[model samples]
Target: MASIHIPTLMLALLSGFAMLGVQLWAAQRSRLRYLDLAVWTWGSWTLLAGFAMLTARVVVPVWVSALLGNGLIALGIVFYNEAIHRHVLGRALPRWMWWSAPTVAWALTAWMLTWPLAVRTSAISLVFALLLCPAILVLLGPGWRGESSLRAVGLTLVAAAASLLLRSVHALTNPEEYRDLMQSSLGQGLTFLFSFICLIGAGFGFVLANFERIARRMEEMASTDGLTGCLNRMTADALLRHELERGRREGTPLAFVLLDLDHFKDVNDCHGHHAGDDALRAFAAEVRARLRASDVVGRWGGEEFGLVLPATDGPGAARLVEQIREAVATLRLCDGDGHDFTLTVSAGIAVAEPGGQLTADQLFMRADRALYRAKDGGRNNVQLHDSGWELGMESPAA
Candidate 1:
């Protein structure tokens, strides 16, 4: 077998470093998804350092080469897993997990420093495979929530882990033939090749995932209100029409709630437009907090918000809007001067009966008419278009 030279591994390490730079540049140029970029960049550095240390194994003490090289490579695996979790789950992993995994793996590497070279290498391979478990768990847990690139990331990692396990078992079974892994050996060459392939595959997968996320976020921003973080009028109007069609076709009830802040202009006049924006944000927060996940809330127009609740009847939507109205009353907003004040909302609810062929505008107009009645009867109340005065429940405190 031709001996695997140190310069060859150095070239691979250099390649990884170059890719990391390219990924960093792409991240900045696009101005999106720095988390994956940062995580994978660390992974590249760890692998590069590990390979550099491995190349010096001939000059260094056996224990130092084994400990540092194996420890760093294991750490690279852990970080790749962390990147997967971040992109897929949109959350930070527990501090103990990524923080302590490499430490613990390094401890294991240290303990195995005195063992036979083949045995130690095999044991470390097993540790590397185990370190990949976190990423595997995330990828396999549930659906990707519409991001399909996550599946590729997960599968690529799974293949890498399987390859590691196979090498571990092979080394353990034939210790005599694979005793010196640092030398030009077929086993070592294969391991290095697999590591390089995994680095390329998973790295590209991460880039693709981040790009997909950026596109989706851009779409969201386009369709969303900047201040309130709710759907904008255009998107809300389109959604109402879509839901109306579905309710008509599938025989499901759909309700729309139109909400206006009582005396919103007064707050603006007294506290400035900034305070008005704050109140609008506060109102949107209450709407989000009190509504069901299936319910869609949006900024319909100036000082007016709309809600689309699928599978909801008139009374059910009434209770939801009433709860939202109460929640709004409790919201406290601070003006530029740091003084806090509360706001109340007037809500009007209209329901499209199952199998009804009402248009989006029809539903909107009905809810809007009820809103005028709530304004006329007095503010801080929920009025239903279908039930008229009977369902015109005014807040006792109002």
Candidate 2:
């Protein structure tokens, strides 16, 4: 039996485990947690099983290490597909194709452990390497949008597999010289470097992401209303201007909704300012829940709020704002004593064509006109800034 290279194995194991950690972190981003976590979990399991295969010296045939390593490698690929399904691939592996990856693992494991490992048996290892090639292509496939981390991962895996394949060929071509302590370690060290060292560097992407997420969240808070948890007038207007440019360039539909809490001063006058604050908070929460994820909501200041809905037409904008209006009416916020008071908000919606001539200021002016109409007509309704209504209204246009 070949003795394990203690240092090389230790290094490989550590790097592999570190990569497993990153995989776990990356996996958490998936809306479906288990599907992604399974990849990292299986990867760690493969490493553990590989270690066990190395340590249990007396348990199996001479080539048992190769079989165990290859089997776990194949299992890792199966889970790799799962990760790709949720993350890099942007689609789920089909039921049949998904199951086949596993079926491949099970069958390949049996073959590796039992086969005599003559040149004929080594064919199985070749098959696993081939699978990585296609998996690499899909996992990191090229994009019109340019390169991605998945593509980088695909490149790394492809090169690593190539190194492994070459080393295998080298060993087969010259078995005697490749069988020594120094020789074995050198071959394995190169393989380990190929398989994992480049990826260890890539792990920094996770750290970068973590820091970026933290910074983004902090920036969001700085520009947001603490009580309502929406962007403040300053921030929202800044964002709207940016989006207005995008709307013009992309030729996509955009809508603006300007809203105000009706009789908000009276809520403060009647129930106290604390109640008004609660209403604002409740209003923000309701608006947030009602808007599509693509929609942006912000506190326009002093019981006034605003939204920008991209890729939505006028009708869609109206329906959504009306839904928000109705939802705000039904939402019962409480005072400190836990008394429920139903609140109603008025909304004004304005939409523009893609690359529309309207500036952000123009859009806000239109929406504000609609909002004023809603207020004048009686609150708790959504009004659109049709041709006649657009000329007059308050603007939080910034």
| Most TM-score-accurate candidate | 1
User: What is residue 42's positional error in candidate 2, in angstroms?
Assistant: 2.9
TM-score for model 1? 0.73
- Please write out the lDDT profile of model 1 over residues 1-398, one tens digit for every residue: 56566356666766765677476556745645477668876787787787767767779986787678777887777777777767677777677876577787678778877778778768778888888888888886752454688778778878888888877887878676576754556666676567557766877777777778788888989999999999999998899889888888889999998999998888998899998998888788878988788889999888999999998998889888888887788777889999888898888888999967677898998899888878988889998886443477543211
The TM-score, computed over Cα atoms with residue i paired to residue i, of candidate 2 is 0.50
**Candidate 1 ranges beyond 4 A from true positions:** 1-21, 56-68, 81-115, 137-146, 182-192, 247-256, 269-278, 288-295, 309-340, 348-359, 362-366, 382-398
How close is every model to the real structure, measured as TM-score?
0.73, 0.50
Q: Write candidate 2's Cα lDDT for 1-398 as tens digits.
A: 35346456655666566565656566656553444445545555565565455444346654565556555556655555555455444566565654565456446656545443333223543555565565566645542123344455566667756765765565566455344323344554455445544434333332333344455667878898888889888998988888778888888888888989888887887777899888888788888988787789988889999998888888888888878878887877777767667788888888878755888888889898788878888777888777644365443311
| Per-model tally of clashing residue pairs | 2, 0
Instruction: Looking at model 1, report the run of 10 residues with the lowest lDDT sum.
Output: 389-398
